[model samples]
Target: MSAQQRRGEPPPLPEPLSPLIDAHTHLDACGARDADDVRVLLDRAGAAGVQAVVTIADDLDAARWAADAATWDPRVYAAVALHPTRADALTDDARAELERLAAGPRVVAVGETGMDLYWPGRLDGCAEPSAQRESFAWHIDLAKRTGKPLMIHNRDADAEVLDVLRAEGAPETVIFHCFSSGPEMARTCVDAGWVLSLSGTVSFKNARDLREAATLIPPGQLLVETDAPFLTPHPYRGAPNEPYCLPYTVRALADVVDRPAELLAEQSSDTARRVYGL
Candidate 1:
C-alpha cells in the first residue's frame, strides 16, 4: 500500500455480530439523501443483525423525518424531543405537534435530551444553564405524560443533571443515551435503575473511564448503541458509523465485562427492548 493509504488506515475487522438494536442513532441525518439511500442503510443494518433501531430527532423537522423513515422501514423506530442545545428552538406550537408525532406507530422514547456544558461558551445562546435546565425539565415532563423513557445526553453536567432528575422524580426507565461518564456516575445510575447505553468511545484506546464504568454496571442496567454517524466504534473510529458497526463495540464491551460477545448482545438487546418499550 502507498504511504497515504497506510496513513489513513481502515477500521479493524468487525467481530461476529449477534442480534441487537441500534438503540439510539440519527438516521435522518445520516441517510436522508433519498429513499434508496435509506433502504441501503437499512439493508446493511439488517444484514449485520440489528433487529431494531430507535432513531432520534433533535428538532421538529428531524422528528417528522424520522417518523416518515420509520413508516418506510419496519426495523426503524422513532424518538421525538428537542435536544438540549436546541431547547430554545422548540416553540409552544411544538407541544401539540410532538404529541401527535409521539403517537405514531413505533415512535418510542422522548430524547437525546439533557444538559450539555461541554461547549458552554460556544454556540450562540446556548451557554445559559437555565435554558438547558428548562429543556431538561420539559423532556422529563414529556416522558411522564407520554409514558416513554427519557433518553438523555449528558456532557460535562453530571451532578446537575442527576439533581434535576432526582428532584423531578424522573421516569423509572431513563437512559443515558451515550453514557460517557466515569465510574462514579455509573454506580449512581445503576443504583437508581437507569440504563447506561455504551457507545463507540468504549472501544477507544484511551477510554479507561468508560471501561471502568462498564465493569461496575450490572448486566440488566447496561445497553449498547452505535449513536451512528457519530461515535463509530474502534477500528471504525474515523469512519461514519452505522448499525452494522455495533459488533466492534460489543466485542470491546464483552472484553471489559469478561462476558461472551453473544451474551452481551442478547442482554443489551433485551435491556433496550425493556427500556425503550420496543
Candidate 2:
C-alpha cells in the first residue's frame, strides 16, 4: 500500500475478545501529542479490548518523548533506543541521555534497535552497517544493565542480528519485534529462548512464511502488537492503524496458529507482561 493510502481513514475496530496488550506501537506517530491525546487513543483501544500499549522510540527525541509518555497514563509503557537506521546519531550525549531514559521505571525495554540492512544505500541518511552494529550492541548492554528486555528490530539482516546478539551476549529477555523471517529463523529464535512479537504483517495474504512461523511459537514466547500507524491488518491493509485495531491482528493470528482467538489473546497479553515486566 502507498503511504497516502496507509495514512487514510482508520479501520473500524474488531470485536472485543479477552483483553490484549499492544506490545509495540508508536503513539507519537499515531497523532498523540499530549496527555489528553494519549488518553483518547488508549480509551479507543480499551473499547476494543486492548488494555495497554508500549510506545517505542526510534531516535533521541522520541526516546525522551516515549519516557514521558509513559508517565501520562497507567496503561502506557515505553521502550527507548535509537533505531538502527538512525544509529549515526548516537553521539556521546545522545547515548548518555538514552542510558538515563532506559533506566526509568516506566521504560520497560531497550529497543527498536538492531540491524536494518534493507535501507543503507537506498535510504538517505540510513546508518552504515558498522554503526548500526555498534549501536545495537550498546542498546543490548543497556538492556542488560537495566534488567529489562531487549527489543530488536531486524530487517533483512536476521543472520547478522543473531550473530551480533551471540557475540555481545544477549540480555536475559530478548524480543524480536515485528518478526518477519521464515520458519528457520523463527525456530532459531525459539531455540535461543527469544520472544517473537508478531505484528499485522502476519495477517497479510502473502506472508505464508510468517503464518507458518507463528504456528511454531510456544504460547509463552509469543506476543502481539500493532506497530501502529503502519502495517494495519489485512482488509484494512492500507488504512491508518492504532491500538484499537489490534484485535484484527489477533484474530488473524489465531487463524494462522489454529487457536481460539480468546485463548491466543490471553496468552499473548500474558507473554507481553512477563517479557516487559508490566
RMSD of each: 2.4, 1.8
Quote the lDDT for 206 in model 1.
95
Predicted structure 1, TM vs. truth: 0.93
Candidate of highest lDDT = 2
Q: Tens digit of lDDT per residue, candidate 2, span 1-278?
A: 65556668778767887679999999999999999999999999999999999999999988999999999999999999999999999999998999999889999999899999999999999999999999999999999999999999999998999899999999999999999999999999999999999999999999999899999999999999999999999888888899999999999998998899999999999998888888
Model 2 lDDT, residue 170, Cα: 93
lDDT of each: 0.82, 0.94
* Residue 27 local lDDT, model 2: 98
TM-score on alpha carbons, each prediction: 0.93, 0.97
Model 2 earns a TM-score of: 0.97
